[model samples]
Target: MGESGAGPGTVRPGGRTARVRAAVLQAAGDLLAERGFDGLDLAEVARRAEVGRTTVYRRWGNPSALAADLLSDMADQSLPRTETGSLDGDLLANARLVQRTLADPRQGRLFCALIAAAECDERTAGALHRFYRTRIAEWAPCVEQAEERGEVPPGTDHAEVVRAVSAPLYYRFLVSGDPVDVPAADRAARAAAAAARAGAFTR
Candidate 1:
């Protein structure tokens, strides 16, 4: 059976079309969390969302597109970067955000499911790459600011520095199966900041 409150009888206090889209996306996220990408069925999503199956089919066409759309929405809704006036502080903020997200039950599972889907679907992979690109871009300015302040050498690769801040956390989250905690987040931030200072990311 479909989830309660997502079914047709629920009233949403918004434009009908917007409500329908939100309901559909919410249903899709729930199913993705519950069953992974292989289990994402548009018909089921539509039924759960109280939206017509035909609308789902006509709009998304396939599960990959649906998953891609979800990723796009997630990227759009993600928090903006923190400006802490120091490389270490800003990078720590970034790492902590990544750690918190990976440590979240629903969000962790959703990310794992999306990554698995990307492995088997080119379009999904592209969407996933774009999502990361957007996130990295959002935080890259912190490193650029660090460079301007002479905390890091001139010509440091700002994006790489941003990527470094999250790499270890993601490695633990996606590869090592280790705990992602505040200490780990701090370590990742410190390591990235140290590397940037040492000119490891110089262009």
Candidate 2:
């Protein structure tokens, strides 16, 4: 299998290789969601994926590497940002998207597992950071557009603005354990928009 030029854990192969990768990642995600990182066993994952243990061990080597690959796959599959023609509208869209994902049963548990795994594993932590960076870059253009429209200061940090919109939602998801509903999402979006307009994210 030829490795993708993008980065680690981003191999893009065809035919049997691709099928094996897909099955492995799917099994890994299920296991992570079910038992977090501690319960992620390469042999069990191989069984769940219905693939050879040798194949799983040779391809990923360890649970952390498998987690990294799963995160890479997630980054590759994440949805594109919504363009709504206004800063508030765009930010609202972003906030709602985050809220929905973090509020979903399976997805929410999966993310919690990933975050917990990242806390203890350096490789998983790096992969998690890279995943968020990729997501932030994907949505940062909305803030840049707002700046171009004179909605915010010229030096406003676009990525920071985008992060602000998600910070509160994530806080609820990972810390406060509050429900991430529509109201919370809307509040986060408005707060971020207000902060941006107030030059709070200025570089």
Candidate 3:
């Protein structure tokens, strides 16, 4: 929540231990963006965070695990699902959030780096998948709300629907290398919205 260059002093106390953990997690994210999965050094991370290296190793065990935790933390901090009184609007909002996240100067490259690293690392891949699941779960209710409003079929897969809105953006990032611009986001949202209406995402 603090600026990128903010000191470790911004850490607050829900409890002393919790504050230290939070500082370590935030620092991990910054470091991951600055360096990368392969570039990550646990000792260096601990030193920069002003936390103990032993504690870091004991807690997360390794760089990949630390990346997972950092990503999971980011999902928790993501904006709540937008309910704009219309299914199309809600889906578009979700798409736009994805677009914005992938377009961030540092976070964008950070994600690309993580995804590439996960390709050969099963543990990292599973952890990254779980992170996506968390984000999808957070937004699933919007789809459910749509079903209740008769905007989507009753059997529509809410999680899948939310995931659909993001699939194209990731495809572009990972495969297509196409622009994740506003127009692309809008198209992804509209496509997902239409598909859901027609039961494409329904089980």
TM-score each candidate.
0.91, 0.93, 0.87
| Tens-digit lDDT track of model 2 for 124-200 | 99999998999899899999999999999999999999999989988988899899899999999999999999999
TM-score of 2: 0.93
Count of clashing residue pairs in every prediction: 0, 0, 0
Best candidate, lDDT: 2
lDDT of 2: 0.86
RMSD of candidates 1 onward, in order: 5.3, 4.8, 3.7
**Can you give the lDDT of residue 103 in candidate 1?**
79
Q: Order the numbered candidates by lDDT, best leading.
A: 2, 1, 3
What is the Å distance of residue 33 in model 2 from its true position?
0.6
What are the per-residue Cα lDDT tens digits for candidate 3 across 1-203? 10122222245557977777787877776677787777778888888889889999999998888877766666555567778988899989888888887887776877777787789777778877877777787788898999999999889999888878888998987798899888998999999899999989778
Give, for candidate 2, the lowest lDDT window spanning 10 residues.
Answer: 1-10
Q: How does model 3 score by TM-score?
A: 0.87
